[model samples]
Target: MTDVVQNGQAKRVSNSAIFAGCAVFVAGMVGAAYASVPLYRLFCQVTGYNGTTQRVEQYSEKILDRTIQVTFDANISSGLNWEFKPARMVNPKIGETIQIEYTATNRSPRPTTGSAVFNVTPMEAGAYFNKVECFCFTEQTLQPGETVKMPVVFYVDPEIAKADETRNIKTITLSYTFYPSEPGKPVAALPEGNKAVDKKL
Candidate 1:
């Protein structure tokens, strides 16, 4: 009788342990689902070159020409407070690099953390995108009212000069949009089937 009681008690403990473990697993899964949707959305907004919002895709051949327009669009989805600025932009002839600066702020009442992703599509030009320095590609945490300056350096492939379609183009605007990022979450790819402006020749 004593042995049987002991065995029953051991079995009950084992069952309880299994139930607790399953419960934790389910909770984790639910949390993941909740966090994944927004991150995915951010990914799409950053990567998708859809023409609805502002984007950069062209450059003037005149190096001394400062006539290029720098466009800005603000995104606050991740509860992030931010700003972007042009540090310095050079209108290179054909084989020169362009550099720009961006600034971000944490306007939230509480501490917040996230990352910004950026994409540049040079319409009618084939330029290799390079990041000399930027805050958009990494995770950043800001205290209340804290602000930081970010920089990006990129060059337009001179080969674009060879294309007649890009020769007449007088403007290339570099645009940046901020997106929220979280660990263990999947970033969303740009929206599919949306009519994206054809920047490619």
Candidate 2:
């Protein structure tokens, strides 16, 4: 009787351990799946500052009377291997549409595909800005030694020009960086916006 009871207790302990392990595994899988989308988005935003989501705005324009023309600049960081350029630096007037063009070449021997994300920090009135052409949202693939010209079309809102906070604004900077694509992932594509005759480079 004692032997049988002992064996039964041992079997119950083993079964409990197995059940707990299975539950933990299932919970982990569920948590991972639930967090995947948000995690991916966070990664993209941090890596490139894609400017898809709106950020908190803090505008100050105490120098409205100063001689300053709102200018836009570009910055390319390290770790991303490519050549880049800007089509325009200073937009003449509010609501004026301008194109910023850049050429990217794959420096590595292997075919490369990745997304270019950007951030625009304009003077106080920059929030009224609208982008008509943007490659930042789409993933681009380049064969070795191949180069492609990318364009971003944007206009500053007229309201910004009239705003008290932006009256003295002189420049806005748009910066971008690229990152490697995950293996076996489908290329992410974004629809192109309003078309303009871009100077073929």
Candidate 3:
């Protein structure tokens, strides 16, 4: 019965090995799934994929004489109780830095927080649109009936004028959509006896 005992032990060991291998594989897949989102965002930022624009701290000194019309669009996602819109349209020369404002008002009686997601139109133009400063980079919390004007400073990369695909393009549109921060989270009511702070737009 010694041979029988040895065969059973070998079988058990083989089954244990298979189970261990599957556990490791599953763990690896889970890790990869968790990492995919940030990785994809980084890839989009670098490549300007899907109309994702680039962020910069400063614009180049070279300003092209060519001018392009830039239109701004703002949207509020469903369930976000806020009014959002662009203040104006602008025509800026390539490589000229400009700042534009968007106003957001919290219409709900409760204090609400939102974060904006932005993109550029004519998808190929995204690679050429650069933002020096944008309020969309962070979350904004507004008191009840509060209004705030958020700004975005950006420029069209002068190099865009040299690209055959975008050289002839005369207009670009930047769009933003504000969504409630953390879906399903209850909005907190403004604290009693606290006056809403007046913020300059």
Clashes of each: 6, 6, 0
- Provide TM-scores for the models: 0.50, 0.56, 0.88
Error of 3 at 90 (Å): 0.8
State residue 140's C-alpha deviation in candidate 2, in Å.
Answer: 0.7
Tell me the tens digit of each residue's lDDT in model 2 across 1-201.
Answer: 999999999999999999999999999999998777667666543332343322212323222223333343444456556666655556445555556676677777877776655555642343555565566655666778777778766665555557686665666666666666653452333222224333345
Q: What is the full ranking by lDDT, best candidate first? A: 3, 2, 1
lDDT of 3 at 198: 29
- lDDT for each residue of candidate 1 in 49-149, tens digit (9 for 90 to 100): 23212223444343432233333343455445554344544554443445655566677787666655444445333232323334454456666877766
lDDT of 1: 0.50
lDDT of 3 by residue, 1-201 (tens): 999999999999999999999999999999998777667777777777888898876777899888899999999999989999885889999999998888999999999888778888898899999987777766678889999988888999998899998898999999998889863332221111212322476
> Looking at candidate 3, what is the lDDT of residue 105?
95
> Could you tell which candidate, 2 or 3, scores higher by TM-score?
3
Stretches > 4 Å off in candidate 1:
1-75, 83-90, 126-129, 183-201
**Model 1 lDDT, residue 29, Cα:** 97
lDDT, each prediction: 0.50, 0.57, 0.82
